[model samples]
Each structure stands twice: as C-alpha cells, then as structure tokens.
Target: MSADGAGGVSRSPVERYTDRMVAALQRLEASDDPNLTFSRLIDVMGRSSHRLLILLFTLLNMLPGPPGFGGTIAWTTFGIALAMIFGWPIRLPALIGDRKLPLSLLIKLSERVAVAARYAARFSRPRLKWLTGAAATIPFGIFVMAISVVMTIPIPFINAIPNVGLCIMSFSMLNRDGVGLLAGLVVCLLGLTVAAAALFGAFELASTAIESIR
Candidate 1:
C-alpha cells in the first residue's frame, strides 16, 4: 500500500517507508491464518523483507527478556549481517522460521516501531545518499556483525546499547537517509567501545578475584 500525499503532493522517502511498515503490520493483523510464522511474516513484507527484518530483530533485541534471549537475537542478527555482506538470500532455518509468533505480541511490537518511525520521519530525509548506497553495505554489515557479537557477550545491562544503534541504522536504511546512517554509525562505534571496556573490566575483576583467592 502506497502512502499517496494529499492534494497530489509526493510523500518523502521516510514517510513512504513508514507507511509501508504500517501497511505490512495491518496486513498481518488482518490475516486469518492461525499459524503466523517468521517465513510468513517475511513473505508478507515482500520487497521490504531485508529492511523490515532488520528493524524487527533490532526492536526485538531492545525488549527485556529471559536469560540468553539476547544471545539468540545477536546470532540471528549476525546471520543477517552476513547476508547483507555476501548478497545471499535471507532465509531462516526451518527450525526457527517455522516457529509460530504470538500475533498479539507481534502487533504490539510493530505498533511501537511504527510510532517511532512516524515521529522520526518528521526529521529524516534522503540526504548523503552516498552513505546509503551500494558502496556502504560492506562496512555497515561489518559494523553490525561486530555489534551483534558484542551483544552476545554476557555483559549485564549492555544489550540495549548497540541495539539502539542498530534500530537507528535500520530506520536510516528504510528512509535512505545517509545523514541518519552516519549518526547510526557513530552510535554503533560508541556502543562497541563501551562494550569492549565493559568486557575488559570484567576480565580485570576476574583476575583480581583469582589473585585474592590464591
């Protein structure tokens, strides 16, 4: 579904992407199929698959969850990053893709993301087009892959940091906003630095504990 501008005005890229996401969510909500799997969700997203999946996974990573859930998301995102880098087809394994998602929870998450997208669309535009172009995919994929690895570390209270960057990156991609991509890159770097420091501190603490025990 296209978001046609009122009075024949053309919608911005940000607005268009946001509208696409909302429409996809609405379609999911309207579906009568009882078993809504990840594969089905991707099929519903059509050409928006890559961008929407990145957005979905990033948002899912931001949510609080039980032990090891962060690692799961991190690994999934790792695969996605590899796909982005290698130009491989994005597909989940049957084990994961076939798993059913709770429609209500999915809708709730999509609603939150949609609201954020709409708000961001006000300030986002397609500038610095070079950064969002084909040349940038390799670097972006590498950064995302690194961040995903950091997220998998059992660093308490740090899972959300990189994810915030990832969320921005996803939005920037959708909106084709290179300026936003630069901002997202900065955030990802900062998050990576913080995670590295935290990991270093953890090792230091462990070493101190071992010495004390000795």
Candidate 2:
C-alpha cells in the first residue's frame, strides 16, 4: 500500500512487476519476428532487473515442462551467472548474446512468467533487508556461480530445481525479502546436492562397469 501524492493509489512492488510482465508479454506477442533475438527480447521488456531477465530465461527453459534445450539454456544462464559474479557492469557475450527465440515460445513463456511474477509479488515485502544489499553480493554471486555450474550439466529434470530456486531468489531480491532469498538459496543448495549425488553414483557405476569389462 504505497502512498500516491495525488489521490490515486500507487502500485505495490508486486503489482508493478505484474504490470511489467504483462506488458512485456503483450509486446512479444505482437512482434513480427518469427524468432525474437535475446537483445530484441530485452528491448521488448523495456526495463528490467538482471535477475528478472535471468529468471525469464530459466522459466522459458522449463516452460515446455520437459528436459531439453541443454545447450541454449545452459549458456544463457551461464552468461547471467557471469554477470552476477563480475558485478552488474559486465555485459553478456555478443555472439550467443543475441541468440533468437521463437515468437510462439515467447508467447507461451510470457504467460507462465507473468503468473510467477504475480504469485511472487503477493508475498513480497521488505524483510531481512541485509541479505539483499550490496554487502551480500559476493556471497550471492558464489551461490549463483555454483548453481550455474549445475545448470550447465545437461540434466533436464535435475536442472529444473536450481532454475526454480534461482527464480525464487530473483523474485525475492526484487521484493527485498531476505528470508525468501535465504529459502531460495537453500533450495538451490538442495538441488546441487542432489545433482552431485547423482553424478557421483553415475561415476561409480561407470567405473565398476569398465573394470568388469577389462
């Protein structure tokens, strides 16, 4: 319940996010490009935080509700993680940076992302303010990098967890909810632990098989 100087009501943070997300979706739906480039997609979004952009990519990767697009999603998330690590000033790579996405996919993704934004906005309020500030960036960067590594491993279902965590973390950041950020990090850690265990099990199984064959 933000105060408006005039008698009109001001939009809450979540409301603002919902509006922006809806507007972005409409813009994408109207684009003539059969394939929308990343840069162009950002342009359509008008202005957005880095975390929001990263979360959109994550959601798009999961929108089909299946594990696929290993290379594309992995690289995109990786680029975003790099931005987090090096601080916000760094730009994504120009080569794949401008990679294109289908208009149909964007339309589908926009709906899903908007829903998430709306949901997140409902609970988002200023809390645990310390965790969302500049002091927390380095530690958060480390966490982002760790999850980004797991994200690149080409495991579909396994990757979804971390992507979801990142989305939560990003939304929480926007809301300035430190508790939500902490919870999101916990999810990311759990996902990473699961990924690590699976990888280890696979490695051991492969080793035993190779030895038996020899």
**Winning candidate number (TM-score):** 1
Candidate 1: C-alpha RMSD after superposition: 2.6
**What pairs collide in candidate 1?**
none
Off by over 4 Å in 1: 1-6
lDDT: which candidate is best?
1
Q: TM-score of every model? A: 0.87, 0.81
The 10-residue segment with the lowest total lDDT in model 1: 43-52
lDDT of 2 by residue, 1-214 (tens): 4754367755456456556766776766666743577666666654335566666676666655334465566676666656766665434566755766776767756666667655665676768889987777667667766676677786547777777788788777766789999888888878878888888888999999999999
Candidate 1 residue 4 C-alpha distance from true site, Å: 1.7
Once model 1 is optimally superposed onto the true structure by TM-score, how far is the C-alpha of residue 41 displaced, in angstroms?
Answer: 2.7
Write down the lDDT of every candidate, Cα atoms only: 0.75, 0.68
Model 2 quality (TM-score): 0.81
Task: Estimate, for each residue in 147-193, the C-alpha lDDT of model 1 and write its tens digit.
Answer: 88888888787666678988898789877888898788788778878
